[model samples]
Target: METKLTPGGIVWKIFKIIIYSLMVFFSITFVGIFVWVLINSFKTAPDFMQNALGLPEIKWDYQNYFDIFKFEYKNNNLFQMLGNTLIMIAINVICTISFPVMAGYVFGRMEFKGRAKFEAFLYVLMTIPVIGGASAQLKFLSALHLYDSYLGIFILSSGAFGSGMLILTSLFRGLPSAYAEAAYMDGAGEFTVFFKIYYPQAIPLLSINVITSIIAVWNDYMTAYIFLPTHPTIALGLQQLQRTADVHGSDYPLMFAGIILTMLPVFIVFSFIAKNIFNSKDIGALK
Candidate 1:
């Protein structure tokens, strides 16, 4: 079949071309900057200052990677800061998956009195910015003695609400109820129906949520700064490292090295889960 392009089709094609061009331009710019930083990270302070935009004159300075571990901020070494960041990221991912799974399944699949109102409430809660209640939240956490503690941060981040809830709820609703009904006919318990049946099906969506939570929490410094002054995460530590580098002067290469090191974990995590996220078949399957 031959089709002629209409005026609207021509306009849409032009729009798409413009959008793709912008995307390509920005992607190249980002990669160029990243490569420049990586190349400079290998050079000495003076070498970097002399040729900020050029490649290294000598072999790569592998020591810069090791030196990152030795860098300290407020008595917290790189290892300690990395550990703190990992802990928070792990807690955030777990809570985001687990809490949303249970809550979303219940509200999405089951019929119960006041369920509509509860869903409405969750939607309203999403409208409220987290920072809007920072003062009260800080006071509340302090009153409960959760401030500056891992458990406190875990609890604070483990709310069974927000955009994730809405997404999971919709995901559950899209699924056929026959699966759960069959499991029930076989005398399966609620736990089996949820954990064994539908939960496994939700893994793809959950993986996406995990990646998002990890990246968000990994890059988050403000929350940790106020709630956990004693336990600085990688992001907070990076800020401190930058300040310390500035004080010493001519240590921008080392600061860039730290930035690369901090970014590596996020890249690794995303790579591992990227496959699962893109393959929607795993999530779309009835089984």
Candidate 2:
């Protein structure tokens, strides 16, 4: 049967079209800028200055990419920075995912006293901006001798009470309770039910958190700069590189090369796992 569009439906369709148009416009602009940077990365100093937005000459300089990896600081290179980032990300993933999943499962499924009060506390913590806690965090890290340490960052990031925890809790709440009941009837314990049943269902959300967390940590400069001045993530290192470029502005290609390298790992990781992250229904597709 054919149905006529209501006036409200027409207005909503117009609104969606306008929004989609804007998204496409901005996306194109972003791609254009990225392409410009990539082109400049291969251009010579004279060619870049003369034709900043133009394509590269017949000769493309591939050395900038190589030189960026060779960037040295106290015997550390790009490879060491990669290692440090992976290590921090590994600890962060374990701590963030494990605690949140457990906490979410408990809050969403289990009946316990003071649950309302605990949730209120989490809401308060979530509403409080992190900037307000900077000084106290510094003091706490100092007291524990965790300043300039990956373990310190891990501890800070592994909180069970946050927006992510709340989101996971809500997701778990929305899931059917029949699965849990069936598992329990089969003699499955709380841990077994959560791990084998609930956790698999939550994998999609978990993947989203993992990607966002990795990107956040990868691009964060201020936190690492304040707490771990000795340890330089890619963002901090890029900032240092840009500062050096201020002295030698002509070597802009090198800086652009570094920028590309900085984005590479994130691109690779997302390309591999993006389907799993976004597809909430397609469980175990990758495996």
Candidate 3:
């Protein structure tokens, strides 16, 4: 059976088709670029630029992977650089997750003098631009003999005292006090209630916040550049590579290899947590 469409309906349908086509085109283009990079990562310098947009012209040069780690200057291996990046990321994740959870719990549950003042302080801290604080933080770390150290960068990145507090405070505020009250009546102390009741309920929000913090820290370059000057992270290292290439011609294959390596961990982590991060479960409903 054939159904006839009105002229207006036909026009509308055509518009919808065009819109969808554009969306698909853009999506494919984005994926294609990454695919190109991934494939070219396995190519030699000559073949990479010559046939970058085409399929691999020869056997996948697995040596590209080996060469990346092997091509070292000044006795620094790429593997060590990757380890440093992972260490920084790990520190950021720990501080972002733990500090925010406890601070959020306090802001949400505890009643004490200067509570409002402390909350206000957090808000003020959030308003201070990160760039402005970098110099002063570096100096403070220097005074404390923490300059050019992993601990210094960890402390700077992990100072999750502001945005994390805000996000968790909102989540905590939305939680029902009835649960805590009941726990209190049941002979549960403050710590007991927080650990046994509140912590369990906050997991979903915590997961989301942790994922967010991970993405931020992973992509961050300025802080890594300024504070971790001696210890270059993936972001800083990539920037340095780009600068080097600009000065001394391009090495497309090596560049693409570096990019693919840089993005692989983030892709894996997000793929694992994508389901939970996007889950629609209500944190407040957790009993």
Candidate 4:
């Protein structure tokens, strides 16, 4: 069966080919970089320098991976650092997702005065970077006596004006209002209507927020470096390992190994949710 292609069909095929080619190119580059890092993770500093793009010079290159656990950063072992990271993820995830979803419900479903303006304000603020005010933030944390504390970092990271707010807002808006009306008819109050009627439906979208927070909090080192001096995370520990590498004299491979371990959790989690997170219609995809 032979069929002649239209001009539009031929153009579409060409576009498809170009897109596929780019995906393949970028995928290869990404995988190649990761593989290179993994390979280098096994090599000694000298071995890495000598055979940057090749296999490890020595047969037994797994010692660096072991050294990660053996070495301690400021008296905090790698597992303790990992524990701190997990705790941070839990606290930050709850703080970040909880308030936004609550506010998302209010502004999203319930119409009120200045709602649109408030939403606009959040959108404007989103474009503004908070990087410049690090000193002020540090001072603020100190003023609250929360300096170098988990609570301080939690408060700092849990801003409501983020994509979670926007996405969950849209999700709530797209939901059926009839459920709330039915709840109200059953003598349910606002809290009941929200908790019983609406909140459950939002789990999928909220999971996205949780997943994002987990990855973000997992990778965030600066906050821990600044505010959690007592607790070191894998991300911050990796940097500390590099900075102290001269003193250690051979921890470069250990640093590389730590890097791999640090990214492993995020990589595994992203693999599962990449399609959903990357989807064009985020709210619609959940529904």
Which numbered prediction scores highest in lDDT against the true structure? 1
Which pairs, if any, clash in model 1?
Answer: none
| lDDT at residue 15 of model 3 (Cα atoms) | 100
TM-score of each: 0.89, 0.86, 0.82, 0.84
List clash counts for every candidate, in order: 0, 0, 0, 0
Prediction RMSDs, each to the true structure: 3.4, 4.4, 4.3, 3.3
lDDT of 1 at 9: 98
TM-score of 4: 0.84
The sequence of per-residue lDDT tens digits that candidate 4 reaches over residues 1-287 is 98899999999999999999999999999999888889989888788767788888776488878778976888999999999999898888788758988988987898889989988887788888767687898899999998888888778877776767777888889898887888898899999988888899888667777788789888898888877888988888888888887686755677888889889989999887777777736655332
Q: Cα deviation of 115 in candidate 3 (Å)?
A: 3.0
- Write down the worst ten-residue block by lDDT for model 2: 278-287
**Candidate 2 residues 158-190, lDDT tens each?**
888766777788888889989889989999998
Q: Where is model 4 poorest over a 10-residue stretch in terms of lDDT?
A: 278-287
The superposed Cα distance between candidate 3 and the true structure at residue 47, in angstroms, equals 1.7
Score each candidate by Cα lDDT: 0.85, 0.81, 0.76, 0.83
Q: Candidate 3, TM-score vs. the true structure?
A: 0.82
